[model samples]
Target chain A: MDYTFQFGVIAKHLPYLIGGAWLSLLLAFLAFWAGAVIGLLGAMGKTFGGRVLYRVIDVYVVFFTNTPALVQIYVIFYGLPDLGIVLSPFNSVLLGLTLNCGAYLTEIQRAGFQSVRREELEAAETLGMSLWQTVRYVIAPHIAKTLYAPLSNFYIWIVLGSSMAGIFAVEELTGRAINVSSSTFRTIEVFTYTAGIYVVLTVVASALLALIGRHAFRVKARIF
Target chain B: MIERIVDEIPRFFTWYNTIFFLQAMGVTLALTLIGCGLGSIFGFALVYGRQTRGRLFTPVRVLIVGYVEIFRRIPFLVLLFIVLFTTEGFGVRVSFFGIALIAICVISTAYISEIIRAGFEAIHRNQWDAAEAMNFGRVATLRYVIMPQAWKVILPPAFAYFVMFIKDTALASQMGVLELTRVAKIFNDRGYSAFLTFGTCLLLYFILSYPLTRFGQRLERRLASSRNR
Candidate 1:
């Protein structure tokens, strides 16, 4: 119980850690957008495609969602080399996260698709709305309203989840913290600071997301 | 490379290795169950604390809220490191498994408390008023009225969180806990093909989680339908 605090050593490495924080955000942003594209397609296929297509996407979603992203990345980063396919740690973590995020987002976006009632679509059609107009004025808004909060929450989940990249040597915020703690031998202080950074990073991300959701989608996302 | 993996398969599934993997899976499950089980209890306590009224309870509510908001935002990996190092710094001789359990419990309590709070909030305010009119204390009201209704709403998401933790406990491997991922790392480091080792690790996790997920979905649907009725 006699451990003295040592913020002084970690102070010099603040910029390095900040750079790592930026990498964490960049990683989450990239994976989220990439996953969104995959999820959109998967949701569409599951909702409207043939049974075979539905089954394929279902399997992908099930497999990815059920497995840990860390192990999935482990398989990709370590196991893939056995099959003559090697990826950089960053690429492997990104690929793992994208696939995992896609599975969850597929489920989320699919729920959004289901939330659109048939009556609403029929009403738009009865109003003489074209396909694009119906999609724009009726369907898009409906989906956006239903999906915005969960999507933002998942984005923040990805931000937190991206800490897994540190284990794979990605040099993100957690990775840099590992480096500093190992080098400085200030394990507790280093991790405490890293956790603080993560808390601040996610709080800011949540607030920004809440603001965007409020204005853009009219969804009352909670900031805290 | 393919041939190498093929060659390693027979060796990988030996009786000893099979037992090793099964034991590792047990550790993973134990971590999830113990962690989330404790989490649910502490989470309910947190919800109760936060729901208390009066100026005296304001700090308690704020502290509970701050714990939830801050802990939920921190990544599990960082939390693990913090727990690991903090325990070390305090010179407590905790096992790696104990460290992992502490981290999981801390995070799950934060998350499950939010879920429990939302579940309680799902009950109508009039229900609380009715309980108050009957002279029921907060504990009595929660026990007799709110929990009966709220558990239906809480069970599905809480169960989903449990399943999520099954996969997440894989990170415990990073801190040298001999969980499934650690087993895979051990086998792979022992000259086994990574494809065979980690692939089996992935499949084992899928086996563990997929059924619980299906059950949670079914529970959600059933509860939703019954609630509507």
Candidate 2:
């Protein structure tokens, strides 16, 4: 099997690849933000709400945990249209990934929420803080401290997981690799180059997340 | 349509296709399991390597960091393609199945190593001193004193990662390995009821993974309670 490896042919597709990387960043960031907000709500519901709410959140986590993110994406990308609900490719992928991340984040945040000491809550109450104020000023900060590392880790996980968006033709970095591989007929070369791009993207994302952890959460995150 | 899908199941469950998909699932699952298993070993090795206080510790530390970063950064799909086509020389052509398994193991090792490292760090320092005071060697300490405890702490992360590994198997489907997702794709292309086909596939994966998550949660709770006691 004589196979010629040509860098030039694939090199021409660099711009598109870069664009895909940028799109991936956008997808991940949006999903991260959305997941964070929903995670907070779900965590709070599970922790503070009645049994029904807790049960609801429990089911949510089980469903999301059990299903593949790719399957989630496919369900939204392909399954929804069958129900007469048409979503754009990008929106469908983003929605799917965000919801998936939210479920995982909800579980992580719930752990953090459960860790806030009862004495701390009592102290907040003794200081005449309302329930909302106690949660806002006291509980949230405590959860923030415990949750920061896992949250950052989850952010990185979602960023890497977003590579699967390629399957949906969302024009993320992985999708571009598929295109490049088919066009170049150099499946190995195209994917290898894409692999390098992925490494850079993940590294950059991890570093940026670490920086955010330092500045935003004021927490020292040990990145392994 | 639902009745049609019900009928197709027994037809699709032919001897040849059954063997093919089961073999495919087996190949995919084995690749991930072995990859994760080897990765865990390497990961544990790094954890112990880091614990060895020495002048060369800095480089060892950097190597571990570099390993995790490199593997985690690259997409598995790309790794599969590259390793499958390349890495053939000296009269050794690594099979597609081989490359897929090796690639997953390579990636799994990086993550597993870090998880093991974290588990080690979570162990109280005094526990080591207690083991040392008992005249236990490093191996003995790890095996008898540390590992049982550390495994509990690591179970939540490791078990969660196992589920991630199962999901990651879908990526190999793109490389022409007919796993669940691949079969779903084939069914879709063949004008099978796409809804029933994919819905069933999704259900199958859910059935497989949900219990693992629940089991991990239970183990985690038990560990926490025992630690408190």
Candidate 3:
């Protein structure tokens, strides 16, 4: 078990690796924000919309939740071009991640929606609040309170899941590491460095989310 | 394009081709089963270690926590790549199937441990004393008293984790394993559209995953109702 560890090649590629990490973070951030919108709407639809809307959202959640996000990415990135709607690798990965994240977030946010009290909603209405206002002022606060922890975890999930984009040549964190490793044949150093970046990404993101939740949403969600 | 779906796709559904697909699914199921089986046992060990709180258990708890934190924090794909690529030069001669399975097992063990630990926490501390008073040994108490109850909480999500493992196996397609996703890749490599091939492939996955997910939900409801009664 005598193997020399080489940090030279990896050190040389540090800027490239950081670029990849930034891309991964960028993809995760976009997906999280977009997924949140989709999830919020889906939750609202299931809670109060017509039966058709409810059923549609239900199917979306089921299909996405049941399938692998990687498969979905493959399909979206590769399949849609046949129908004359081609997307670049970056667009494909983002679209893939946003839709998949939307499905899971729908389920998570629905749980938050279900936990809101019926009387509180009525009270909002009595105070002359419109539907959006009722949701914005009353339901949003309640859901945000409960959703902080799960959303924090979901955010981390997106960051990690974004690594799959590397396979499609997006050159995100993992992809960049693989390129350096394969080119340099410094598999141990490159991958170890990449994996370390991932750990730092998750840990730092968790702490940032906790602080955001405390200040913005007043949810005392623990980072651990 | 519609012609591709309606006609060209059917030619690929012959028994020989279907067998490849089935074999791939079989590999996936094997990965899931092996991962779940070994992962659960090891996860139970973690929770068992976690049940202790003295300075003597500090090292054990530290080791377990360190493992869970590292594995769980990292994406399974990254872990898979790390294991599949790094270990080969170290004289670990695991086959691609073995590599994929072990990677899944290692990652799954981390999550399963947390799940079982939470289940253990749900049980009352008084229950431990009750088992002690009844003259039950540690292993006996665990087998009879703790696991029987913990499993009621563990089994449903554990099944869902099975679904998750099935999905995770798809990532191993990059490792050259002939799983469903790789089978889809093989079809696509034949000048077929990756989208159409993997689209059909994902449907097959939906078929596999949808049932397990629904059943997990049903089991969760059953547990809830049975408890209420």
Best by TM-score: 1
Stronger candidate by lDDT (2 vs 3):
3
Residues A49-117 of candidate 2: C-alpha lDDT, one tens digit per residue: 999999998888778877777767777777677677889888988998889888988989888978899
Could you give the candidate ranking by TM-score, starting with the highest? Answer: 1, 3, 2
Clashes of 2: 3
Candidate-wise lDDT, in order: 0.93, 0.78, 0.86
Q: Per-residue alpha-carbon lDDT of model 3 for B1-229, expressed as tens digits?
A: 8777767677777889989998888987888888778998888888777667889989988898888888887877787787887677576788998888788888888999988887777778998899999999888888888877877877777888888778878898888888899999889878777656897789889988888888889998898667511
Second chain TM-score per prediction? 0.98, 0.82, 0.92
Regions more than 4 Å wrong, model 1: B227-229
Residue pairs in steric clash, candidate 3? none
User: Would you list the clashing residue pairs of candidate 1?
Assistant: none
Candidate 2, CAPRI quality class derived from DockQ: acceptable
Q: Per-prediction count of colliding residue pairs?
A: 0, 3, 0
Ranking by lDDT: 1, 3, 2
Higher-ranked by DockQ: 2 or 3: 3
Give per-model CA RMSD: 1.2, 3.6, 2.4
TM-scores vs. true structure, each candidate:
0.98, 0.85, 0.93
lDDT of 2 by residue, B1-229 (tens): 4576687787666787656555655665676678788878887887777677678688987777787768877767667767766664223476666767778888888778778878887889999999999899899999988898888778789877876788788777776666777777776677665666577667777766777767877887877788622
Q: Is candidate 1 or candidate 2 better by DockQ?
A: 1
lDDT, residue A119, candidate 2:
94
Q: Residue A91's C-alpha lDDT in candidate 2?
A: 90
